[model samples]
Target: MAIQSSKTVSACLQWVIIPTGSHICMAEFFKTSVTWVVDFHYEGRPRRWFKAFGPHDDPFQQMTDTLKDLYGDRAKLASVRKATDEEELQYLRGEEPKNSYCPTGR
Candidate 1:
């Protein structure tokens, strides 16, 4: 489910469940006025895509809130931080970063 805000900008939230029983979520911010283009793996075995949109200011919070709302108490928000360039690259390449924040409480 995507949450649309009353702004001209939007953000994307993506997540993947790893084999270690941890989930990694990434939030990418962008403006609605500009054409945002992202090319990466979207379909394959053991891979899924979930997207949500919110205000451009704080995508991490929006993502966390959306998860919590969807999963209720079962949702546990772990560390949230900005993904470095290398981390983003690794994610684009279908690799989880070593420094990724995984949901450990689940």
Candidate 2:
């Protein structure tokens, strides 16, 4: 038989959350069998990076927990919301859209 090297398998989710009145927080969630990695961005730049080694089976839960621990009362968890299509486009373009939620910033 031929020898083969094992490759790591992972899943990723990209989303933006607006926690109550706070500025938009962009997040990317990456999950593998042994760990979870999250990257957070603000105004198209890296803000925070987090990684957790897991015995836990749920990646979503890990993401939620990480967010909760990072931004507490200043951000309301129940108000966490997804990014709009325009917001995603703006982020990818590294510039603010014409009708952006926060109109002042570029």
Candidate 3:
């Protein structure tokens, strides 16, 4: 279930409290699930990462599809491409822009 209006994820964080937490919830917070494009792949198996979400908020069905569709649409893609860095920060709280770039600062 989504936290909805509440910004705090403490309750959800408690779900990971090993006495601690569910394996799935742990996976989501860590961003190590296969759903994250650059996320770690466990052993040789790619996890069904979106399975951590409840059916109601289906991240895969909702966010991923929208992301893919926008990626395929030139107009939509152009709009986001013009976003300023500050605006981009707010836009990607969870949303993915197809040409995601991660700076390594290396």
lDDT tens digits, residue span 15-47, model 2: 333344222212221222232234444334433
Best to worst by TM-score, what's the order? 1, 2, 3
How many clashing residue pairs appear in each of the predictions shown?
A: 0, 0, 3
In candidate 1, stretches whose alpha carbon ends up further than 4 angstroms from where it belongs are 1-55, 97-106
Model 3, 22-88: lDDT tens per residue? 7667766646422222211223322211123332354434444554564443212111113345544
Higher lDDT: candidate 1 or 2? 2
Q: Pick by lDDT: which candidate is best? A: 2
Flag the better candidate by TM-score, 1 or 2.
1
Error of 2 at 86 (Å): 1.4
Candidate 2: stretches off by over 4 Å: 1-63, 72-74, 97-106
RMSD of each: 18.5, 17.1, 16.5
The TM-score of predicted model 1 comes to 0.37
Off by over 4 Å in 3: 1-55, 73-100, 104-106
Ranking by lDDT: 2, 1, 3
